[model samples]
Target: MNRSAEMADLSGTIEVARVVLVIGLVFLHYFAYPNSRVPPFEGFDPNHHQVATFVNSFVLFFFFSAVPLLSTISGWLFFGFSARPWEAIRRRIGKRGWSLFVPLVIWNLGALAIAFALRAVAPTSSLLGPFGIDFAHFGLWDGVDAVLGLTRLPVAFQFWFVRDLFVTVLASPLLWLMLRHAPLLAAAALCVAWLADFTFFGLFIRTDVLFFFYLGALARLRGVEPRVGWNTTKLLLLVYVVLMALRALAPLAFDPSQPDQREMLDLFTRLARPLGVVACWGLCLRLAATAWGEVIGRYGGFAFFLHAAHFPLIIFVKFVLWRLVPAETDAWMIAHYAAS
Candidate 1:
């Protein structure tokens, strides 16, 4: 294919990937944990509620790659098929300011407003009560922090992805240089930091994300387009299933330190992330090739909105669900997942 055709094809793949990734976000924020409640996340026994237990396991195990894959996609798009290095990076940064930063600020303020309102209306509101925030005593500084992610994660925590992406864009020059010259040395250093989940300047910048972004840059540097064809799909499916099974079944037999017969099902979580990225990307590529590709890519216009807004929407959805059901039953949990 010619350069223009290739770029167009990759763009469609990325749009499809963004849509799929946002759907994963729903599975993420809206997850109905086995014993999750005020503090969220607790016991796990597939026996207790087979569907709820394993479905959540699917969310936990498979969806962990959403962010890493997203970072890779973002970095790839930034450098895709560009010959003018400085000009391309500058243009990418400028466009990101509009596409990412603008929406980030708007959504951050919107979330902060909703959280503050919920807190003020009812100090013990489900919104902030469980987090032990005496929203009744929330101050101007707290408001500032919530909006800007100063002291902690921003009120719209998911937007941290956007924030981090923007940061990476600003630093892409350095990352590109590192990836181009001393590729092995740079990747090794990033590997240590990624494994540790290092945060930069207390900004909630995940190094794993940076490392994945680096991988994407490396792909561009090597003129490699990440594609999984029909030939590889079967093997990918086999490995994905095995990982899924390991995630779901391994926890049932082993006991965690909780001592309540609760098994930590995420033993293979970190191990499966890279695979998850590959699988999800493969799905994106395959989906982007079909007749439905253009249809879904059209909704890419609202993908950012859906992603940022869903965090608060899920909160509202859960509150209404709690009011309707007992919140403990397997039926209730399934419904919660469905509504979310």
Candidate 2:
């Protein structure tokens, strides 16, 4: 086939791959591990329930692994066909406008308002005793602490992809230049950066940041679509199965009052995490080749927003439902948890 025909085939294949990645992400978040444990009281206790663990193990893996893979690859394929980086981004931002930032601000404010309200009413469940800020803990710096407290908001963390994506969109032009010149090198650097953020700096460095996402975009942009052959896919699937088994067996290990569970997961997630992401993505891509795949492809643009909005949306809806039912035995909680 001619070069033009080959490029067209490549683009079509990438579109399919992108759809699969997006679907995999949605499944990982809602289906794979929904009620992730969050350590209560803030310590390294192994028995704590952790929200971060669920987000990282299920939601984050899909977001970081799949979305970047899809967006970057799709962007790259389109770029190869003559779309300019700035022009594409301009079009994207123009369509979305300032609507995207609304979620970030709303999530932040919502988290704070809820926390204070909870503290005033529920006290114990709302804030940890020794670790929490109380009347005694209050001082001139109380206000400053309050603002910083927003960073710890669990609901806000759910929409982290929004802040991260904003960074990616902003940096697209520079990322495009780098991808055009050196794609493999860019991917390698990003992998190193991710490892450093996860293992070394821990939560201080957010992998969801645009620079990391941009790296995935660069890989896809540079046309580095490695077709994982059937054998590779099978091997990856086997590894994923083992990891999920481990996950099921690994009971809630970290307490919120101690070491972050994310650190614990990051340490072990090293071996099987990437493998699972690749396998899941590969399977989705294959599935996307059918009529259903075409339907999924149409929703690709909305995936990021949906992923980011799920957490806040969940909380907002739950609060409304709580007002109606006003009981711990409310049936809505069951349905809400089951749905998202």
Give the candidate number with the greatest TM-score: 1
Clashes of each: 0, 23
Give TM-scores for every candidate, taking all chains together and pairing residue i with residue i: 0.87, 0.57
Cα lDDT tens digits, model 2, 1-340, are 7778766545555655655555455544432222323321121113322333333343333343564454445344334434565776677665434655666666556655665666678776513331234554655455343333323323345444455555455556666777768767866776677665642233322553443456446545555654566677778877776565455334455432345675665556543546655675566556555687777666756655665545434544444544554343324434443454
Local accuracy of candidate 1 as per-residue lDDT tens digits, 7-87: 789889889888878887777776555255321133245456766666666665567788999888877767775587888
For residue 41, what is the lDDT in candidate 1?
A: 31
Query: Which is the leading candidate under lDDT?
Result: 1
lDDT of each: 0.72, 0.50
Off by over 4 Å in 2: 1-99, 102-155, 180-182, 198-205, 208-212, 226-231, 247-265, 270-273, 291-309, 313-340
* Residue 122, candidate 1: alpha-carbon lDDT: 75
TM-score of 2: 0.57
Query: Which 10-residue window in model 2 sums to the lowest lDDT?
Result: 36-45
